[model samples]
Target: MRVVHLLRKYNPAEWGGTETAIQRLFEGLRQHRVTSVTYAPSIGSSIAADPLTEAGFAVKRFRACVPVWGISTERKRQLIAVGGNLMSFDLIARLLREPNVALMHTHTLGRLGGIALTSARLRRIPSVVTIHGGFLDLPESMTNNFRNAHRGGLEWGKLFGALLRSRRLLKDADAVVTCNRKEAALLKEKQTCKRIVVQPHGVPTSLYRKDHRESAREAFPSIRDQRLLLAVGRIDPVKNQRWLVEQASGIFRRHPDAMLGLAGACTDEAYGESLKRKIDELGLRQRVFLTGGLPPGDPRLIGLFQSAEVIVLPSVSETFGLVILEAWAAGTTVISSRTSGALDLIQHGENGLLFDLGAPETLHQAVDCALLHPELKSRLAATGGRVASAEYDVTVLAGRMKYLYDQLIAEKNALRNSAG
Candidate 1:
């Protein structure tokens, strides 16, 4: 079957939840011998480059303004506007013309949704859209006020315009998929869709095994002596990295030997700078280290997971936290925010610790508890590892995805045959 994966970006260098999810799904589709193609924006002239592989699938590049002129408040608004217009018209036309493209699975629902809906309508190709976030549920403070005020601006009209347009796309999709049950509930409440599937993201267990720790430590000497606490994700406001820093301060007050390591690139430069300033202000500059971006196979990456006392994800909102499963597969205990989809996978005090996202004190307490109670850590790791291996392994996830795709395709074909 021919499948096209549509995403805003495909570069691994720019690490985000959506990018990681799409990469894993693409890899899974390849394992099933399905013909997969990826369509994303060009990397342009920046330090960031597109990482799509040529061996397994074809890569289609579209020009969209992003990460340039800075991903500032104003730039983001403009990008969204331009993206919605171009994608709905030009990109949609192009995608519909692709021969033998049986399915177009979109990873987002803003401007990309417009493209997917348009393509599906014009070409009669079945399309699926995955909801990675509650874009429709975003608070009003984050909306583009200045753009709304400008001429040709709908004012309060722009926000409603985008929301209505997105709803139309969601309603038109052949199948809708979400990462967790919470998101599925939200989708059902918000949109009228025919099919909704909940498919959690998976991680490769082989990438993180018991024997890789020593090799990982050898590559990063600084973590050898320190009791490392690792967190990986974009350094953005929604991720609540500041909350993690505050929690680290409390944890360090108790155990001065503990250190926090942050892996992943900053999505916004201003936000990244603010985090660095906060670290300095709190006297955490010595203990908190930000390792920019690391390759997927880098030993230091695996070692960070293996050697860490506990992995923490303090996000205010997350559709799914793939890192939680990855850490568990590496036999590492986790302490994540209760708001995340990881909550569905982690059993508090049984598999791993869970704390309220709003309570930094609770997070700090969980960290201290995990650090002091070695037996609890070991038991959680062992049990969590067993759960991850049995349930969230990439191979198992691939089979599930293939079955879903086959089922969706058969239904689409049957509908067409009935119409004919």
Candidate 2:
């Protein structure tokens, strides 16, 4: 089966959790004899298409203009900070003529999303839309700021957008997927979709278990000491990396050799700048390391997980924490915030430890517990590793997805026969 994936933009340099999850999902889908084509808006005149193409996926980049259809490479930074990028309506033509696109699967919500859904409907193909990032799980203030009802392609398209909003993607899709169970319930309450599936983000557990420590240590030498505490995600307000740095001083007092590494692209440049300033203010220049965004499935990422004594996730609003499974695959202890995702994935003091986000001191305690109590860390890693290997592996998740896809396709065919 061939699926067409739609997104606003895709650049390895600006990779995020959604991109990684989609890549891993595709990896699983491939095992089921499924192929995918990704479409995203061109960054002004440049698409940076080589990354996805070279990675062995078919790609089609639609041209877009700055402010409306696209953001210039220079302004892309600013756009990322504020969290709104536009896509052109002209992309619908590409969808209409898209060859052999048996199904449409959108990992993002934008003009391209509505177009993809519409195109799939016209072609009589089942469409699936996944809310990869559960923005609704974010703090209300953050949600309001990022999801300005009047902004994005909606504002740019004006009357046309009013006529056909992206919200239709949610209502019209044959299946709506959410990584977070809470988000799925909330979505079902708000939108009357045909189906809702809670498909958690997955990774290649077997791949992560490999021995890549040598290369990883070379890339980030701090791993050599094996006293690293890592936080992986975009440097944004919602991620709460600044709070991680703020808690560093107390952590340093307990374990002077401990190093905190923040790995992600800076989506919020202003927030990123503020983090740097806070690092300087706290005099954590040498202690807290900011390793800019690494591509999906980079050896360094797995290696960092392998090398870390404990993987700490301090995000303020995480719908589903993929990092928890990754830490399990790496046989590393997990210290996660008490968010919906973390709570769902972790069994407190059993598989992983969870700390209150409002309490930085609790995070400090969790970190100290992992560092000071070797037995607890080992127990946590062993149990979490088992869970990750058995349940959250990409292949296992993909099996579920294949079943869903088959079901949706069969239903669509039945409807066509009925109409005929």
Write down the lDDT of every candidate, Cα atoms only: 0.73, 0.80
Model 1: how far is 291 from its true place, Å?
0.5
Native-referenced Cα lDDT, model 1: 0.73
Ten-residue stretch with the least lDDT total in model 2: 149-158
Candidate 1 lDDT over residue span 2-38, tens digit each:
8887876555565666666666777777788777788
Evaluated against the true structure, the overall lDDT of model 2 is 0.80
Compared with the true structure, model 1 gives a TM-score of 0.88
Clashing pairs in 1: none
Worst 10 residues of 1 by lDDT: 80-89
Candidate 2 deviant stretches above 4 angstroms: 44-51, 65-77, 80-85, 147-154
Off by over 4 Å in 1: 46-51, 65-74, 77-89, 135-165
lDDT of 2 at 25: 84
